[model samples]
Target: MTERESPFIDRTGKSLERPQDQWPPYVIPKEAIDLEIERLADLPAPNNGRRESFIAHPRAKEPGLGLAPGIRVSLSVLKPGERTKSFRHTATEVNFCIQGGGYTEVGGKRIDFKQYDVWNHPSYHVYSHVNDTDELQVRLCYSDAALLEMMGIYIADEDPPSVKEEERDYADEKNRTDPRAKNPFGTFQLTDDGAWLMPYETLINPETVESKAHHWPWEQVKEHLDKLSALGKDYVGRRLYLLYNPMTGRTNGTTPNFFATMTCRPEGIVDRPHRHTSAAMNYYFSGRGQSTVEGEIVEWKAGDLMLSAPGWAIHNHAAKEGTVYELTIQDQPLNIAMESLLWQEDLKLPAAILGSEAGFGTNR
Candidate 1:
């Protein structure tokens, strides 16, 4: 790097540029693993009323595999019959259920969650999780929690919510900008028993009633998953975009801070390189595969995770000729919202990438 690009500088007017290995836009194939659960189980509420953070603390240790300016991913697990302490939050926590089944209590509302379900805990809301089942429950959480804390705008209240569900003093639109309250997709409402109130919507006025929590049920998602895993299919992209909230009908399910989608690379297919500014953190649900991140092969299997460094990493995917299913989280919506999303595809690979060997493809 040149003088301006050097990271280290002193009064000598010279700088030391770190090695390229330190540079990001690379992959961290599952920086976190099941080991986190064992560690957390030894502790107590949501955090065991404690916390075991994977991300580094400024005063303590070196940084882990992560991105800059605010994107972060972490883990939280609760043993069966364990519950987290209730609190009003200041962090944006979006969770993808890694395993186990339970419900989360948010603002006096109940959200039933199961394996592979995606949900968000809104900022400035009262929330906690309850594991009622007989197995270990893990949550793959993504958020800008550390970012807000680092910026000095962080807000967290240990106090519980004083207002009951029936007594919440909310305006017609509690907070329009909050994705939870916005509810652009579905018409739902609050009931006395903490159940959702699903109302009908009219073309004239789409906003009728809505609920606080949103869930993408895996039961409903399984049909699509099965259809994508067909044998020798003539037409298939093997990728599913998890946008469009079924309730709200909005094209996206996530907030601007993050968006997640699922893709499947079936047996014997090799994908070409593609790049974008939005870094992708991929969680492997099932399959065996290897990714070439800028020529760095990152091999992964079921239950592992990987990252495609943001900003121009030539990444390609291939299974050991085996089936692979990937769940990816990226800040693509954020970049697009900020008008900074760029994408590129490698021109060298033939159309065989998507199993389109005939050189025939349909735009639709």
Candidate 2:
């Protein structure tokens, strides 16, 4: 075999203790984003009718260029009366409309969304965006495309078929009659310690849970969020609500890979320093704030986007004035699913693997 084909490294006795390369916190000011939106708006419309830009971190590499290690954020804009071509991808997404209003057609369903609305796109579902109104539409889309790209499985189809054929019910006729579908030797316990042996027939046919798109309008969410301010100064927990999708189950995410939370930080409210294995990015829309990330203070105002917390980096935020409304996207669900979500709710306490252990609680 050629030397290029035999790509193997001998590490029989090499030292395993190597420092982790954690990315530093970064921020994209409102001005930079506004300029980019203007620039995109000025450009001639592309053939696909989609004008988008990826927000890459300074330390990010080609395989997974994203603002966070596993979370990819992209800015998309559409002119009035314009619409994107039909497209589908393996990576699920959380779409947030930051400016104007539009509607998205996904999986034969139409979702009409306004400014500050949040919605999820299910995996492998063909979708397209339309701006039927007179105003320009701007959106921030967060996805696991970066992670999928790193894994060499980020498949996207720009020319998906305009009409998807009706799905056949496998369990209705053929599966019920097929002898191979029924396993004579079913799964059974093999050990007292909970070990079990599953037949190949059973292994290939796992339970299916239908995943659907859900929308949370900002006005509806805001009404509920504003009530949390009454929790007063004595409340210890953050005032936020996870835009949960039931399909994620115990993972607590908007998509399988990420959780999007809308936070309401009352004036002068400060959070206690905490750390987690999942990286976090925040988009502040309504007020100014400062985040102390890894001992470095980073100030931000309304319309700014920030990489508030790198994985496992201690961080905290304080509202400077008025009620601060921000949308935080974190790769917590992926970590939790992997049983690697180490969360430290308090600096003085020990960190615990969140999904696998007893998690921390706050005084209500």
In order of listing, the candidates' clash counts read 15, 0
TM-score of 1: 0.69
TM-score for candidate 2, residues paired by index: 0.94
lDDT string for model 2 (1-364, tens) is 4466567877898998867667889999999999999999999999999999999999999888999989899999999999999999999999999999999999888999999999999998999999999999999999999999999999999988654575667766687678877888789999999999998766876888898999999999998887776767666777899999999999999999999999998888888889899999999999898999988999999999999999989889899987899999999999999999999988787889998898877622
All candidates: TM-score: 0.69, 0.94
Superposition error at 197 for model 1 (Å)? 40
Model 2: how large is the Cα RMSD against the reference?
A: 2.4
Every model's Cα RMSD, please? Answer: 11.5, 2.4
Candidate 2 local Cα displacement, residue 87, angstroms: 0.4
Candidate 2 worst ten-residue window by lDDT: 162-171
The lDDT values for all models are: 0.63, 0.91
> Model 1: runs farther than 4 Å from truth?
1-32, 44-51, 55-69, 160-211, 246-253, 347-364
Cα lDDT for residue 352, candidate 1:
31
Model 1 lDDT tens row, 101-213:
89988766788999988887666678878889998888877776656666767777886554464454466445533566444656455787777655332334464434355
